[model samples]
Target: MAGKLDRFEKLINSLSTWLNWVAGVGLVTMLALIVADIIGAKLFKWPIPGGIEMVGFLGVVVATFAIAQTQFLHGHIEVEFVVTKLPKTAQKVISCLTYSLGMALFALLSWQSFEFGRTLQTSGEVSMTQEIPFYPLAYSMGFCCIVVFLVLLVQCIMTMIRAKK
Candidate 1:
């Protein structure tokens, strides 16, 4: 059982890392697009079409896609100033509880995102400038949220095992 969990953890970690890379690429692309748009507008008196809309979409991608890996790295801010002072058992209990809450929150977000994506798809919603379908971006948000939820679930289970020991 432990071995299986370990394997699963590794798999999730790898996926998170890959997603992080994708986020990095998205960030860079967004930056380039902004710069190019500015240069075109200033120098050539012609701005990139749909540039603002693309940036907005890329912003969402960069933000949502990076969260899972951040969770996996335990990189999110935490007020451990108080938690660290607790006894070992209490600390483990708190960790478990924290991860449990995170899992729940992200699970809800994931479900809602997917539902919103489906609604967008059914309604044929699209972006104003590019006319790009909104559903794919919504679906991607849902995917990222699920990844974060899984990361939290693994942390919660690990904390439980430690508490048991």
Candidate 2:
């Protein structure tokens, strides 16, 4: 069981790493688009059509896609000052509980995001300027949330095992 969980953790970690790379690329693409738009507007008196819309889409992609990687890296802000004061057993229990709650929250987020994405797809929702479909980005957000949820679930399980020992 531990081995299986470890394998799953590794798989998710790899996916998170790949997603992080994608986020980086998205950020760079967004930056380039904005710069080009600015230059075109100032020098040529012509701005890139839908440039703002594209940057908005890329911003969503970059922000949502990096969540799993950020969680895996423990890069999220955490105030551990109070936790540090707890006894060993109490701390372990609290850690497990916290991870479990996090998993639940992310699970709900993923489910709702997926539902919203489906609605967007069925409604043919799109960005006004670019007509960019919103479903794909929403689905990506859902995917990232689920990945982060799984990561947290694994952490909760590990913490439980450690507490047992």
Best by TM-score: 1
Q: Rate the local accuracy (lDDT) of all candidates.
A: 0.94, 0.92
Candidate 1, lDDT over the whole model:
0.94
lDDT of 2 by residue, 39-65 (tens): 999999999999999999999989988
Off by over 4 Å in 2: none
Best-fitting candidate, scored by lDDT: 1
* C-alpha TM-scores of all predictions: 0.97, 0.96
Candidate 1, RMSD to the unseen true structure: 0.8
Check candidate 1 and list the clashing pairs: none
